[model samples]
Target chain A: MKTQNIPKATIKRLAVYIQVLTGLKRDGVEVISSEKLARACSVNPSQIRKDLAYFGEFGVRGVGYYVHELISSIKQSLGVDRVWGCALVGVGNLGRALLRHKEFALRGFSIRAAFDCDPYKIGEVVSGLEVVCTRQFKARVEELGLEIGIITTPPERAQRAANYLVDGGIKGIVNFAQARIDVPKNVPVEYVDFTHHFYSVAFNISSME
Target chain B: MKTQNIPKATIKRLAVYIQVLTGLKRDGVEVISSEKLARACSVNPSQIRKDLAYFGEFGVRGVGYYVHELISSIKQSLGVDRVWGCALVGVGNLGRALLRHKEFALRGFSIRAAFDCDPYKIGEVVSGLEVVCTRQFKARVEELGLEIGIITTPPERAQRAANYLVDGGIKGIVNFAQARIDVPKNVPVEYVDFTHHFYSVAFNISSME
Candidate 1:
């Protein structure tokens, strides 16, 4: 699929759509209209059609969309139809939380291994995965064929974790650190900063006043 | 200052610029040009100017923006100059991680109280705050004067927590749960779904292929 040039915001909504559709499918919903799906996803109906049109036509004239087929198509477009092994760096509180988060496995991204520099955390078993020393990170990533890396390290250590992920051949990263880490051009890094979320809410509430 | 109708995206980037400017100020830098700030923030200079223009003209013609002055101006516009007390519902691993995260306090959002339904977690201190029973949630929010609520609870319990927050008079929410909760029109909710971040990286990597 020629997936280039799709807006990052649209890519984000695709994930939300996947979640909404998964829920609909589980409820035995066989078909749904764009308007209904938009309501489910908290987006507008026009946006639902526009985002999906970037791929191809899946909606029937009268029947709306087949819930099963749309889920399959969105998953395929997202490259998450198959399982992707992931390596997590930093077994700190946040890392441990993500390790225990059940949704990742349900969505086909598995945290196959975890690494940390802290001696207290090293060799600890969290969420059934033994915490490995950071020195073994590259070798372990190669062994496990980790396609993506997740960094939950403190700000100071985030850059080093990214370096290890890159050296280990992991191409994608989900960084939760507040500090921005520089990565090579080809490596895709997604930041999940809650501080930004906090500030956004604060700004919004202040604006309404 | 008339702050109506400013795009939420611009408010978000202003927060980013505030962080960048704060860092520059700490480094003893006196003044910064939009070009330098743009490079630091990974945003275009034109966009930075446009975002600031929504607030007011802060940048001088030739000297660019004074780091200290711009930080104060942006903080005033975003309302992060004042601390926002926050109540966190759920003391699970994710909730514990957030309670331990120091960046919230550093950025003017304080997680004052934690709540959960788990008997094991209730009354236990995590990150210096004792986990209160969920029944105490609304009362604590009233006592603490919490303006924001952070929901890290499971999907099933998310809406109930939102109900508690709303009843307690929380006007803003930063929900980390996978579930969607309906709030009143006046209460603005911000969702921080890491799955969206995960899929964004996956899609970006897939597009590169």
Candidate 2:
């Protein structure tokens, strides 16, 4: 189910809504109103209703949303309900940290393997998972049947990692490198830069001033 | 100068605009119109003009904007000219990776020191900088005369990390912690989450589908 024509901001918030729904379910909450859900997420009430309206009605007119049902529905809407196996190409600090993070599995994405270039770190058990050397990453990913790869290599190594992931038949990538890599248009790449975090800090500081 | 209620999406785009402006300056462009800027960023031309209007008119009535001047102004507006000395806490995977990154330095932010409880990491240098032990973190931070703290600690350890930074006299915090923490009202805390990146990825995938 493709949803275009909506603002990217709205799409991002929908994911936040799903996270809120997850919290509600864990609390054994059965029903949640737009007001309650918005408050829990530190957002406006009408915004929650407005965003949900884009995907058709998941909320009852008076009863609000059925927590578990909404969680399942949002999962389907996000296309994250299906089991996803991902490969991580950099076993450096960021790569290893992401692997040890159990939250991804809790959120429906499982990392099947990790790769690195450092001979010392290579073959070392990192975050409870053995690190495979970068030399064999292509074959290891192929053997594991991973369709999505995460690129957490250093900026200098980011492009090379992307090329290897592409050659491995991975269709999607989440790049954490500061370096921007050129990839074919058909293959989607998402970049997550914590450097943006510093900008936001400055933004808030400027706003205060 | 305070931005007059720009959309968060537009503020984000402003960050991109600043980057592109730097590229244009390097290429020796004197002036550029909205259309060319849009083409470079893959955005709609009218949207760029509209986003710019929230602030005072930077472009002449017909001549577009002066590249070098615009870059200088945006940098000032973004607080990029000021050096923000930061303490890096929780030298886990994400922390270690960030220590090696130079983007923050390029943007005028420095990780003066890093902290972690892991005895193995505390006394060692990971990226040409020593990782300070968490036990002595507060004292070391004051010793360096730093006020900005980067919290790259885990979800469970996030609050405690903030507490330490607060006691350490940090006035600004760029937090990568998944969980929120309470700092004094005067202290500006900017939170960046990996899960939020996941939401953007999920959003992009859903829209593509």
Candidate 3:
């Protein structure tokens, strides 16, 4: 539970490690050495060992880690073992896609409600959840006990949506919009920036040439 | 330019720094000290200095960095100063959202082609690009000289889509699927995994509680 000093990079790596471990578990792999796991994740073996060391030891002295055990441990450490209720704002194309996205449900995060500012989008059902107006965002979020807020609105509307989430007392935010929104320090925000990945891909491809 | 030995983390940070710098430039800010830039990016000032050091010196001795100059230099170093042609596979909701996403075009990535296996999706125009069959992926990629292949297909179809992209001679891949895929060593792949962010957010929220 000593999360205060853990590096953000370490947390992100733990997520990746759990993902790879889940895949290994699916393949019926019982145990995996840090070296093998590192290779699978495209990370340095020493880095993998160091990252896991933040949460205490996991791997055996010689054999390495039990795939299932490591997956469960990491999932528990990341607080993803139980489902988290989430509310999503903006019912645009991107928002609709996120609503229909199966990965969120599969990964223990559930979109319990959807919200939109457009009068036309209001009352429209997407992915089994009826879209509500932003006016109801805070009340609905509080009523549903939604802990996470996902912003998928356009750049101009992102801040307003973020304010609504903040007013709703959302614990964490996942911003898919291209704009930066201000929120209190207590409410952690994670950006799902597609352009960053595009830039990285472009950099690597350009480097090769 | 010396591209070898630059850490992947540095590359990702560089992308973020550029985004922050772009925002500053938009606000009409001309020069910014490393400390200010780091604060905006939520990165260490020394880390920002070190990341920029990989490319070469940019800031003056005591005046900090010229925002426009630094932005251009970073973009040049990242190889994003010029536009890169890209292809998107799978015309699903996510794929359509990506097609309509304006950030990619703004960041110099152009989705020149789209592919899908579904007969209904094929021939349909979404975001100005007509959907094509997977059978035509390789040929269209080669003909259009697309360097980046974006896999937005279902997890089950991701690997096959990757195979087609590789066969078509893609330089890099942006995999939006939840599936881990295999591509040639030369073709660097970046994952846009939403679950990773969700897990991180969940962990932070749980820790605060």
Candidate 4:
């Protein structure tokens, strides 16, 4: 599939569609119409069709889309069909939560290792993996073949941790810190800021009033 | 302001712009151009202007925007200028991290209370607030006058927690559970799914390759 300049929103919706389809597949559902998919995703049916058209057509006339087939195609398009090894920096509460989250494993993403600067946390085993010192981040990332790095360090140390991850040759960083950290152009960073999430929801709630 | 049909994406961006501006404000920056704001936000200048235009003009020609003024306008538009009381259910690792996050307090969203099903954790005081049982969710939400309910419970309990919150008259729900919970029509739910964030970053990282 020719992927060029796909809108970020579309990419996000694609991920959402994959999630919805995965749920449907688990429910023993076979085929689903764009209308059904749209309802599940809270998107318009035409929009769903339009999004799919970008990656090439997978839908047949009248019969809608085969659930498992569509999911497989999306997984391939998303480059998540293969398992990705990721390293977690900062074994704090947020990092601990993420490491314990089972959805990552289900979606082919695994936390191969965790790192922290705290001496108390260092050498402690969490989720069956020992929390290594952040000083060893670059070398450890390389040694573990980690592609993505998750930053859950405190705000003051976030940028430094990001720098370490970049130096470690990480392809991406999922930063949970509220502070924005600069990274190289080639390395994308996704901010999973809980504060921003709270604001988004609060604003949405306020608008309802 | 005629806040009729503003897209969720627009509202989310507004929240992000608030974050960027807040950072700039702390740095003692007084004024900024849309181009600069867009660069800081990782969005196009035209898109930033378009978003602001939806809520009426905030930028002056040639001089661009007054940093403080723009933040005020965005906050007002987002209905976050005033403090919002939110009830948090499930004081797990992720929830604990959120309660400890200083950004939320800075943004005027305060966690007025917390809840959990665990007997050991139920009566424990965290961040100056005692954790109540989920059984007390509805009554406590009412007593606290919480405008929003945040669900960080496990998948199985999410829907039930949502039910109590809704019954207690929460204007919205910010759910972090991996499971999708159904809510009332008037009450909107914002999902804070970490898996989706990971996939978004993964797709972007894949595109860089």
Per prediction, the TM-score for chain B is: 0.96, 0.85, 0.96, 0.95
Task: Give candidate 1's whole-model lDDT.
Answer: 0.87
Candidate 2 docks at the CAPRI level of: acceptable
* Candidate 1 second chain TM: 0.96
Off by over 4 Å in 2: A1-4, A23-33, A59-66, A115-125, A128-142, B1-4, B18-40, B45-71, B115-143, B163-169, B183-186, B202-209
Predicted model with the maximum TM-score: 1
Any residue pairs clashing in model 2, and if so which? none
Q: State which docking tier applies to candidate 1.
A: medium
- Candidate 1 chain A has its poorest 10 consecutive residues by lDDT at A1-10
- DockQ (Cα-based) for each candidate: 0.72, 0.40, 0.64, 0.56
- Model 4 lDDT tens row, B81-195: 8898899988887788777767777889888999898999988988888999877877776677798888988777888889888888888888887667788788878877677
Q: What pairs collide in candidate 1?
A: none
Q: Least lDDT summed over 10 consecutive residues: which range in candidate 2 chain B?
A: B196-205
Reference-based TM-score of each model: 0.95, 0.80, 0.92, 0.91
Model 2 scores a C-alpha lDDT of 0.75
Estimate, for each residue in A1-209, the C-alpha lDDT of model 2 and write its tens digit: 66667676675677677766776777689998878888776689888888877777778878888998887877777677676678888876677778988778888778888888888887788767788876676787667767677888876798898888887767678888755676777567776766555776776766776
lDDT: worst 10-residue window of model 4 chain A? A193-202
Write model 3 residue lDDT over A1-209, tens digit each, in one string. Answer: 53555677788778778778878888899999889999888899999988887777898999999999988777777778899999999999999999999878878889999999899989999999999998897778667879999999987798999999999889999998877788999999998787778888877777777
Model 3 stretches astray by more than 4 angstroms: A1-3, A27-36, A44-47, A57-64, B60-64
What C-alpha lDDT do the candidate models reach, one value each? 0.87, 0.75, 0.87, 0.83
Question: What lDDT score goes with residue B76 in model 3?
Answer: 86
- Predict model 4's lDDT versus the native: 0.83
* Distance from true location, Cα of A55 in model 3, Å: 3.2
